[model samples]
Target chain A: MSDFPLLEREMNGKPLIYLDNAATTQKPLAVLQSMEQYYRTHNANVHRGVYQIAAEATDLYEAARGKAAAFLQAKGAENIVFTRGTTDGINLVAQGYLASRLQPGDRILLTVAEHHSNLVPWQRVAKQRGAVLRFLPLRPDGTLDLDVAAREITPRTKLIAVAHISNVLGTIHPIRALADLAHAAGAAVVVDAAQSVPHMPVDVQALDCDFLAFSGHKAYGPTGIGILYGKKDLLAQTEPVQYGGEMIDSVELYDSTWKPAPWKFEAGTPPIAEAVGLGAALDFLTELGMDTVHERVQDVTRYAYEKLTQLAGVTLYGPGLNQTRGGLISFNVGSVHPHDVATVLDACGVAVRAGHHCTQPLMRWLGVHATVRASFGVYNTRDDVDVLVQGIQRVQEVFLP
Target chain B: MTPNLSDLYRQVILDHSQHPRNFGSLDGAVAVALKNPACGDEVTLFLDVADGVIQRAAFEGHGCSISMASASMLTELILRRPLEEALHLNREFRRLLQTGQADDPDALGDLEVLVGVKQFPARIKCALLSWNALEQAIEGIDGTGGNPP
Candidate 1:
């Protein structure tokens, strides 16, 4: 065994219990070390330098883009544009692609289970462009009532943006089916894979979505870097929203000709170091093997749902235990506010998230203000779930018994 | 490592949570209601005050054991004390939530259980809900030396 500190140092002197990976992951030393090594060894700007340091930086930067593209099974490196994060990536598409394309009568379709980052961008674009915004309704089980989603995708639908996996519900949406239906409606598909990419196999080609976005932090990488995967031809068609340094080709005083594809989309210095960190994080995930991570999260999520449901005070939300959910579960203990539940969990050094989780619409759908969520990761063990279960049982011993 | 949450939620708290003292309203009396809307903890206090003495006090709300127990114990503590002294304890307990220690012990027994709540940070509102309502009632009745009621 490696004699290194477990990353639970933030738990404040009690037993180290971490369950907020869905919010962001605790960086393993590999990611941290890669970032540190980058800063220590070669710290220079990329793409526009003749020096050896600059050459190294540029090569690594482009290599990171290639790694990201391959991870998503995108067509080429040109299809992967580095951005601040998934929200920035989606906003870019909304502003660059849909803003100009959407007309007054056109419809933008989405699901209520979408995080605010995915929901609000389209709303702003729709309102600004006078386009009609429509939502796919949710079922009692907190899934996008897929039947309704299918029925709602009409001829007027221009672009369908849906979460690949719901952050709040932990239910994996039918991305493949949704993509097929959206394409049949003659609409483009944009997937918010922020929750999906880190946990499962995401072949954008297989899902057949035109574009996909996911954040690095949610996938155990540095916070600021994310990948926006677009089809090569579609990326060439969309205009670059952000205009600044490093995303240029021929510039005259009167008019400028911007670069094409990935470079055109990545404006300014870009999260260069963070992108390098993302590459390292990808390397770490590769070492663990994404398939193993997928299976492990599935097992853990199922175990969590089952264990929490069997407990007397707890109520499981989203899909049923051992069902087709992803790496997390959101639940509420009886009569206890999620905030209180999290607080007691914190007292026991069991850190769980307790809030709407940025899915206010989904919260309203579930008839809950918030819920105590325990998300799983590769580092998580059966012991962690047991700790959470025992903690909740202690809550019963404390308050109910 | 396992954390024993039994240390946090004592049986006294469960006793109060299950069978809250002064559980109903006083009908015609000074009432003050407050809610921690962020977390959905609500408390409505019915104080039967006459001749500047709290004759009886009761409450009803939906909340966690901490808030409910705090409400139950708060009612029991202030039942017969002079309105001004009850007001004093309310102020003192609020201070204890912030400072985690207070000078008054006789007026605060198991009430000390929630003093540890300050450590949790997010739940200070849950622990302080009833005490805040009690303070509001005292302030409303006397008006803090403003106009005659």
Candidate 2:
């Protein structure tokens, strides 16, 4: 609790009860100090200078890549590439890997539960490559319909992109099984782990996904730094989307040679300080242990589900208690708009997300304009859920009359 | 509701939200649909124009209380008014929501209740959703509606 200073602050004259973890988590002291230390003592352009500070900066940056590789349990640091965020990472794969491979009339398989970052890039690639995009529908409880997936992942499918955990519904997909299905069909799988990586244990090796992407800020690291993990062989074959400094091996007037894999992928100066902060954040999570963190958040989520279900006219979306769920719950309070509910909750110092959550297609599929989402993090407790329940009661009191 | 929230969702605003005015489509009316990309709230405004005046105005949409109520009051204020005068009120309504001050308070009528929305920087868009639709609808109007005043 003391490590996260922002949680101790006040909103609307009451202690802040932040429940917007799905958007981004508050940074810890360790991450903050690490970024500060990098700026103060190790600030230098990496990989270029002949001086000592530049070498030290290069070491720190590479060490952070090692941390990210270990965090995702990828094969090695060479398999990891630094990106702006999950969107950037997915776009990289779309253009660098799938765009050139896609053939006319080929298929790209996706789920209705994907975030826009995972969905839009594929749409762009499908359009550019003259390929068709197909969607695997969800069951009523928000889980993927495997029967549909089995039927959809035919030989013609060149790529399958999915969210490991639905951002709005919090329904955890069966990634291992999906990966096997895609592999059997000779299609590559891309996992959007933006929501799952921060909440639970994720092993790229165990999942056997061809590619995976996650943002650092969602895991309590600094923003502007993210990870794109790919199989070494696949990354070796994929082209670099961005071209310029550092990524070049040697250059002539009109033609140039390039470096290999991850180095070639990181074209510019890269997010040096942000990567240092992300390394510290992964270290913080590693020290706490991911299983323990998962258990703690699940406890809070179960308590929230129990309390939120008791309220009359409160409709919870996604999975029920018997299903596998994640660290968040999205719901609507009767006919009271989620925006109104969120605003009233803000008056009570309970901050939650209320919008399409960048999943408008899913919103349309769910027959809703938007939903109010109360997500959990490491520092949240059952007491925070109680305040949220109280704030919701206030919303009913104000709007139901 | 807190004092500040009460100011934002006063009784009149609540009434309009519960039962909006001119809330269905009008036959042969010029229509425009607008959505707040941030929140997914959408409103479709329809205008029946004749000569240079707005014969009728209505909306059909779903959104938060601020958006629904603002749409309801927008219909009531713009009915039977000239296109130019209605556009003026739309501008004034937006000014009130953004700055909490209206140059002509009487010109805004029931829309003035949304003045409290200025305090909620995040929700000003909800209050302005329907007016923005109205602006777009007026733009599509042919010469039957004269130039903006």
lDDT of 1: 0.82
Q: Which stretches of candidate 2 lie over 4 Å from their true place?
A: B1-3, B139-149
lDDT of 2 at A288: 91
Q: What is candidate 2's lDDT per residue for A102-156, written digit by digit as tens?
A: 9999999999888999999999999999999999999999998787899989899
Q: State the weakest 10-residue window (summed lDDT) of model 1 chain A.
A: A1-10
lDDT of 2 by residue, B1-149 (tens): 23388888899999999988888987778888898888888899988888778888889989999999999999989989988898899888878877789989998888888989988889888898889888887877854463333
Off by over 4 Å in 1: A1-5, A8-14, A250-255, B1-94, B103-113, B125-149
> Residue B4: error of model 1 in Å?
8.4
Residue A23, model 2: lDDT of: 97
Q: In candidate 1, which residue pairs get closer than 3 Å at backbone N, Cα or C atoms, i.e. clash?
A: none
